[model samples]
Target: MFKIGWLRIANGLIYLYILAPLAVVIISSFHPGEYLIFPPQGFSWRWYEHVLMSGRYTEPFWNSVKIAVVTTCFSLPIGTLAAYALTRYDFRFKNAVQSLFLSPLVIPTLLFGIGLLIMFSALGVKMYFTRLVLAHIVLTIPYVVRTMLASFSQINRSIEEASVVLGASPARTFWLVTLPQVKSALAASAFISLVMSFDELVVALFLTGPGLNTLPIMIYSDIQFNLSPSIAAISSLVIVATLAIGALLIIFMQQRTRKSTDIEDPKP
Candidate 1:
């Protein structure tokens, strides 16, 4: 009982530590003063109103959204296919290939960004949007691949084999049987890819050129030059948005799991 109580206390402290900064930022957003401050001078929504009306971060926000969306679209399918291949097939240098895809997670983002910048410079690649999308796809694919690999490994091979024995083509079995079994994994990969790509900063800093502003870049620039309550407001908005998205994804994955369970073990 003592150990369990201590563990609960420790977990609560850890969660509080993680959430403290977020609480401060959200509270600061309501500051009536022009400048951001802790504990907030007084409660007011002026900053949020300004953020909504000024349109300062609007374009960059949309740019980030578009890049993130495109990154997810390409990364999810490519990563899923790569994961499926790695999981379902045996091939030469398989471990090496998997390592190569997941290398980004271990490598320093700054170093990876620098390497990409150098490579792009040598190739004379100047299209910032295109370059960013490609970079994000490369970075996000490993996440999808890793998540799906675990999910796929957990699925019963007999189920997939049954589909194959029932005269379903390999592609058909994959699309109909194997894929449905891991819908939660797919959703998880998609969420990770979307959020990572959207919140990406280091690579964006190295890869993005002028006239191609992203929300992170904008926030960074503001922090450097313009630190104000509006910045707090925008940051708070992003935090809330991220939390909302994560909640939705969790709900979606739970519903998917429940539905699959009901299908497999229906009550009489």
Candidate 2:
């Protein structure tokens, strides 16, 4: 009981450490002051209005949404296929291949970004949006692959094998049997990949072309030149949006899990 109490306290403290800055940012956004400060002088929505009304912020935000959406579309299919292959198939250098795909998680993002830039230049691909999406896809795939692999690990392979042994084609088994089993995982991976894509900044810094930018890039530029409550307002909005989406995903995954289990369980 004592150890459990201590653990709870430690966990609470860690959450405070993580959430304190977010709380400050939320509070600062509502401050009436032109400059950001902690414990805010007073409450107002001027900064929120500024961010919502300004084309400067909205354009880059939409740019991020476009890049993230396209990146998710490209990354998820490739990542899911790669993960399935690695997890289910035996091959030469399989461990090495998995390592290569997951190496980005250990590698420095700046190094990865620079490497992509050089590789793209070597290939003579110069389009801005094309380059950014490619970089994002590279960055996002490893995450999708990892999440899907973990989720796949939880499922029983025997079920899939039974489907195959029952005369179902591999494609049919995957679509009807395997896909349903991994649906929640796919949703979770999609959420993670989308978040990583939207929150990406390091790769964007290198791959972004003239007149091409993202929300993070805009925030970076703003921090470098000027700091204001407007940025805080944007940050708070992003936080709220992320929390809302995350909550929805959690609820969806939970409901999906319950439904799946209910379907599998025999009636009493």
TM-score of each: 0.93, 0.90
In model 2, the number of clashes is 0
Clashing pairs in 1: none
Residue 167, candidate 2: C-alpha displacement in angstroms: 3.5
By summed lDDT, the worst window of 10 consecutive residues in model 2 runs over: 259-268
Runs in model 2 lying further than 4 Å from the true structure: 1-14, 122-124, 263-268
Please, what are the lDDT tens digits per residue for candidate 1 over residues 75-194?
999999989899888999999999999998999989989999999999999999999999999999999999999999999999999999999999999999989889899999999999
In angstroms, give how far residue 216 of model 2 lies from its true place. 0.4
RMSD for each of the candidates: 2.0, 2.3
Clashing pairs in 2: none
